[model samples]
Structures are given as C-alpha cells and as structure tokens.
Target: MKVIHVGVGGFGKQWVRVLRSSRKVRVVALVDVSEPALAAAREAGGYNGRVPCFTSLQEALRAVPADALVCSTPPDFHREQVVAALRAGLHAVSEKPMANTLADCKAMLRAARETGNTYVVSQNYRYRPEMWTIAELVRKGGIGAIGQVRIDFHKGVAFGGFRAEMEYPLLIDMSIHHFDLIRFVTGLDPVSVQGTAWNPAWSHYKGDCSSSVVFELSNGCRVVYDASWCAQGDYCDWNGNWQIEGTKGTILYRNGEIRLLKVGPRYKVESSETMAPKPPPADSQHFVLADFMRAVKNGRRPKTDVYDNIKSVAMVFAAVKAVKTGRKVAVLDKDSR
Candidate 1:
C-alpha cells in the first residue's frame, strides 16, 4: 500500500518511520508546514531515494497517488484532512481525539460512509502489549465479571507549543486513550459520566490541567478516571496506572507488572506477576501500519475504525460536558447526537 503522511510533527515523524519499516507500506509523500520538520522526518524515516515533501495537504495529494493516508495533523485539522482523504477515495487513519468537537467527528464519519472508505482513529493504547495482555485476561475471565475500573494518567506536558494553546487542552488532546482503553478491556459502552476539571498551575494552557471523572457503563460496571497534565514531582516512568476490580478478583498494572488478586473458596490473596518487557519485534507504529495494510488487502476493517471509535469519542465529549456543567452526563444518549 502506498501511504502519504500529513503533519510531520513528533508523532508524524514516528508514523513515517513505522510505515517505512513495514514491508506492506511504502512512504510516498510527507506533508508539513515546517520545512525543517519535513527534512527531519525524511532523515529519520530513512527514505534513501527522493521522497516527495509538501507544505500543504492539497499539494501532497496532488503529488502522491496513495491507497491510504495517515492523518497525524493537530486535532483541529483532523476533520478537514480526513474528509479530503475520504473524498479522494482513500482509506484514512487519524490520530485521536478524532476531531475537535462531536460534530466534527460525525461529519468525518459521514464522509467515510458516503465515500465508502475506511476511516480509522488511531488510538494506540489499545495496541500496547501489556494492555492487550490485560484485555485478554479480562475477556477470558481471569478477573471474573469486572465491576469497577480506575485509570490514572499523570504527567507534565513537556512538549510545549501549539498543543499547550488548544482550547480543550488535556481531555481533548490526551484522555481519549484512557477512555478508549476502558471500553476496549471491558467490552462495554459508557452510559453516563460526572467530571471536574481545573487549571491550577499551568496558567499558559487554555484548557484544564487536571480532570477527574466517573463513568457508569451499560453493563452495570463503573469506571473512574483521573487525567492530568501537571505532575509536580518526579514523573512516573509510564505516565499512568490501571486497576480493575471484578467479582472474583482484581487486576492491577503499573511499572510494567501485572497483579491479579483473587478470592476463592480456599483463601483470598494477592497473586502478583510481572510481565517481561519485550519491545515490539520492530516498533509499535510498524504494527499499526502493518495491521491497516493487511486489513485493506483482505477487505476487513482495522480494529480502530470509525464506528468502533465512537464510544471513545463519546466518552471524551461526556467528560468535557460533565466538567463544564458540574453534573453527570449520559454518554451514549446524552452526548452523542
């Protein structure tokens, strides 16, 4: 599959590297507003031959004939770029939050439906090896009938630039990963949420620095989330921690280890196990790109397609609304139109 990458930022550069490493994908073009970013990505991407670079999406589209596009641009530009790609009859993989607003997400979904092209929102946390292993355990009833989950992501936003200036800040920019992960692990949709947010320290950021939320899932399970962009002291190595409590047991993951605490007829105890840190065979970016390529070849939808991502997008909007209103918001019914 011939692929064109839009937005050569830090994440965009990673996309180029991953796609280039994949045997199924060829990097046909790179687009970015900054010439320096383009040059840097070209170097890191290791494109020995001449690789087309463009300053504008239109120019890149004109220059590259691609089967699919990866939209790694800023959140605000996601809708426009995705619609453009779908209109051109190319499948699109986008960085999350899928768009700046619920309306924009809906529009992008509509465009994909109208164009009959795949629109995937790249929520990579679901693809993380440790997270995937935990998900499998949950599905196999290792922790039987999950009742509650807690996801916490606390880290200082070191990447200071346009991302810091965005209006929605942390929730829109980062929380989608956690929201998506909860759904991915439990295989449940959120029904409602209550949230609170504040920007106490990072005065430069237009959006909230910290947010706490609680979600009621459709299957009577509950999820609690805490996301922050300001961690004062030494940052945690992985930037987050997760815990799930089930009727029969509890599962927790932190610092690359997973523990299962189960209570049975014999005794109740904490059985802890650490996952060996095995780096991806190549890189995770390569895995996602390769998965997308195989899906395209076999006429299958990638794991993170538009319809599958709506729950995650809905969770984000629900949290934003809950923070603003200081009241619980129903996610699937109240937030989604």
Candidate 2:
C-alpha cells in the first residue's frame, strides 16, 4: 500500500519510520509546514531522493498517488486534513482525539461515508498487550460483570509550551486515550459524565492543569478518570495507572504489570497473578499503520473506524463540557447531528 503522511512532527516522524519498516506499506510522501522536519524525514530513508516532501497538503496531494493518508497533525488541523484525504479518494488514519469538536468529527465522518473510504482514529492504547490481556480476561467473565473502573494518567512534565498554550486543557488533548481505552475494555458506551478541572499550580497555559471525571456507562457501570499534565513528584510518569473491579475479580495495571485478584468460596484466600511483560509487537504507530494497510488491502473496516471512534471523541467533548458547565453532560447521540 502506498501512503502519504502529514505533520512530520515528533509523532509524525515516528509514523514515517514505522510505515517504512512495515513490509506491507511504502511511504510515498511526507507533508509538514516545517522545512527542517521534512528534511530530517527525507534523510531517514525509504524515500531516498524520490520521496516528495511538501510544506502544504494541497501540494503533496497533487504530487502523491496515495491509497491511504496518515494524519499526525495537531488537534486543530485534524478535521480539515482528514476530510481532504477522504475527498481525495484515500482512506485516512488519524491520531487521537479525532478533532477538537463534535462538529468536526461529524463532518469528517460524513465525508468518509460519502467517499466510501475508511477513516480510522489511532487510539493505540487499546492495542497494548497488557491492556489486551486484561480486556480478554474481562470478556471471558474472569471479571464477572464489571462494577467500576478507575483510570489515572499523571505526569510531571510541563508539556513545555505546546500543551500549555492550548485552550482545551489536558483532558481534551490527552484524556481521550484513556476514555477510549475504557470503552474498548468494557465494550460499553458512556451515557453521561461529570468533571472538574483546575489550574492548581498556575501556569501561563489558559486551560486547567488537573482534571477528574466521572462517567456513567449505558451498562450501569461507572468509570472515574483523572489526568494531569502539571502533576509534580519524583516517581510520576506518563503510562497512567489503571484498576478495574468486578464482582468476581479485580484487575490492576500499573507501570508494566497486569495483576488480577479473584475471590471465591472454594478459594477463600484472594488469588493473585502477575502477567508477563511483552513489548508491544511494534510501536503503536507501526501497529496502527499495519492495521490500516491490512484494512486497505482487504477492504475491511479498521478496528478504530470513524463510525466507531466518534463516540470516544464525543466522550472527550462531553467531559470538557461537564468541566465548563459544572453539570453532568450527556454524550451526543450517534445518529443526531
């Protein structure tokens, strides 16, 4: 499959490298506003001297005959680029958060539907082996009807200036991944959410530094999530700690370990086991690209298809709305405009 990638930023460069490494894909083009980044990507190989680098999407699209487009652009530009790719008769795989608003997501989905091309949102957290193992256990009834889920992604890094300057805050920029992961594991849609956010340590950033959200899913399961870009501590890292509790057992995933605790009459003592650590088959960017290529080749829907991902995007928006209005927000209906 021939693919063209947009953005070429820190994450975009990773996408290019992974796509080049994949046996199923050829990186045909690279697009970015930054000349330096494009230059660096060109020197990284696979394109050799033939890979066309463009400072604009229009210019790149005109030159590259791509079967698929990978969007690693910032949140604001996702909608326009995704719509453009779909309109250009190519399937699109977008980085997380889909877009900044429900309107943009709706428009992008509509375009993909009209074009009859697949549009995937790259929520790679779902593909992590640890999370997949936990999901499997949950699905197999090892967890026996989930009761509650708690997810926390905290980091001490200040995000420098890129995230600090955004108006949408950390939840919109980062929490979408965790929210989508919850949906992936539980296979339940969040019906309503309530959240609170604050800029505790005061930064130049316009949005809040820390946020906590509570959600009620359609299946009567409750989920609580906490995320912060301004967390301060020595041991704090980015992986995010997660715990899921069910009637039969509880799953705890932190650092790199997946632990399960089950209680039963036969075994009065709680049983515990630590899952073996396995590096992601390929980095998430590579896995997502591979999945997209497979879908393109076989004419199948990607696991993170637009129709399926729009809900996760909606949940992010709902959390943002909940934080702003200080009230519970209902997720937007899929059929509703």
Candidate 3:
C-alpha cells in the first residue's frame, strides 16, 4: 500500500519512523506546514530525501495517488483532513482524540459510512501485550463480571506546545489513552461521567494538569481515575496502574507486570498468578499497523474504527462537560451511535 503522511513533526516524526519500518506500506508523499519538519521527517523516516514533500494534504493528493492517508496532525485539523481523504476513496488513519468535538467526530464517521472507506483512529496504547492479555482474560471470564476499576497515572511532561493551552490538559490530552484502554479491555461502554479537573499552584502549564473522574460503565462498573501530568514524583506507567475488580477475582497491571488474584469467600485471595502476556509479537503502532493492513485486505472495519472510537472520545468530552457543569453527564446522550 502507498501512503501519504501528513504533519511530519514531533509525534508525527515517530509516525514517520513507524511507517518506514512497516513492510505493509510505502511512504509515497509527505505533507507538513513546516518545511524544516518535512526535511527532518524525510531523514528520520528513512525516505532518504527521495519521497515527495508537500505543504498540504490537498496538494499531495492532487499530485500523487495513494492507497491510504496517515494524519498525525492536531485534533483540530483531523475532521477536515480525514473527511477529505475518505471522500477521495482512500483509507484514512489518524492520531487519537478523533476530533476536537463530538459533532466533528460524528461528521467524520458519517463521511466514512457514506464513502465506504476505512477510517481508523490509532489508539496505539490498546495494542500492547499487557492490554491484549487483560482483554483476553476479561473476555474469557477469567475475571468474571467486572464491578470496580481503579487507575492512577502520574507523569511529569513539559511539552511546550498547544497542550499547555488546553483547559483540561491531563484529561483531554492523556486520559483518552486510559479511557480507550478500559473500554477495549473490558468491552464495557461508558454510560456516564462525573469528574473534576484541577491545576496545582506548583504546575507550570496554564491549564489543569490533574483530574479525577468516575465513569459508569455499561455493566454498572465504576471506573475511578486519578491522573496528573505535572506530577513531581512516583510516576506510573503511561498506561497507568490498573486494578480491575470483578466477582471472580481482580486483574491488575502495575510497574510493567500483570497479575491475577483468584478470590474465595468474603473476597479472600485464594491464589495469585503472575500472568505472562500472550499477544502478537508486534506492539503499539507496529501492531495497530498490522491490524489496519489486515482489515483493509479483508474489507472489514478495523478495531478502532471511527464508529467505535467516537464513544471513547465522547468519554473525554463528557468528562469535560461534567467538570464545567459540576454535574453528571451521559457519555452518549439521547443521540445513540
């Protein structure tokens, strides 16, 4: 497959490298608003200054034909870019959040449905071995019916960009990964969200760097989350420390380890097992890329297709609403997917 990659800088730089490494696709064209970034990505992407670079996706599409369009642009630009790519009959891939708002997300999904083009949001965090193990375990009844979930995430990041300007930096920029991972592992749709987002006086960013939210899942599971992007110490994994409790037992992942606890009477831990994650060899973008390729080949919707991923993005928007209004907000309002 031939690919046209847009926004080849920062995180896009990593996307360029992943694209170069994947044998399933060839980078035919690169697009970026920054000439310097295009040059840098050209080198880092191992295109050897040979692939054509354009200032816009439209310009690239006008000049070259490609099987897919991979966009690493900000969420603000995703709707327009992705809709155009899908309308042009090319499979579209995008970095997370889908779009800035639920309406825009729905528009992108509508375009895909109308065009019959594949639209995949790269929720790469779900492709990890540990995530797959958790999902498989939950699916196979290893944990029985989930009842409660606890997640804590802490990270000290100073990305001197738009992130600093977001009102809920930790919730909007980082929480999507955890929110999507929860939905992926548990196969539970979020029903409602109630949360608070705050910023510590010690924080450097102009936005709230910490958040606490409780998501009511479809199965009445309560997912309690506490996260901080400007944390000073005791940083957790980027995927967060997860403890999902169910009727049978609890499955937990912390410090890069997966463990299962089998419960007995009165929630007594009868036995414990350190599980070795059994997933495909590829991970993160590598694994997502492979899945996208197979879905394209089979003419099926990819795992994180826009139809499904919008729900996860809705979790973020709903949390933001809950924070702004100080009230519980439905993850999916009267308008159902």
On lDDT, the leading prediction is 3
Q: Give the alpha carbon lDDT tens digit for every residue of 156-275 in model 3.
A: 988778788867877877899999998998898999989888888989889788889999999899999999998999988788999999999999899789999999879799999999
Per-residue lDDT of model 2, residues 1-337, tens digit only:
7888898877887777777777877778889999988888887755768888888887778887988888898888999998998998988998888888888888998998899999999988777777777778888888788889998877766565457777666788788888888888898878999989888755556778689999999878899888877776633334478889888878888887888888676546378988774555655666777777778789898888888888888888888889999999998684422
Candidate models: Cα lDDT each:
0.80, 0.81, 0.89
Which should have the higher lDDT, number 1 or number 2? 2
Which regions of candidate 2 fall more than 4 Å away from where they truly are?
Answer: 234-237, 265-269, 277-283
TM-score for all models, in order of appearance: 0.92, 0.94, 0.96
Instruction: Report how far residue 137 has shifted in candidate 3, in Å.
Output: 1.6
**In candidate 3, which residue pairs get closer than 3 Å at backbone N, Cα or C atoms, i.e. clash?**
none
Best of the two (1, 2) by TM-score: 2
How does model 3 fare in lDDT? 0.89
In model 1, which regions exceed 4 Å deviation?
237-239, 265-267, 273-283, 333-337
Clashes of 1: 0
Q: Number of clashes in every candidate structure?
A: 0, 0, 0
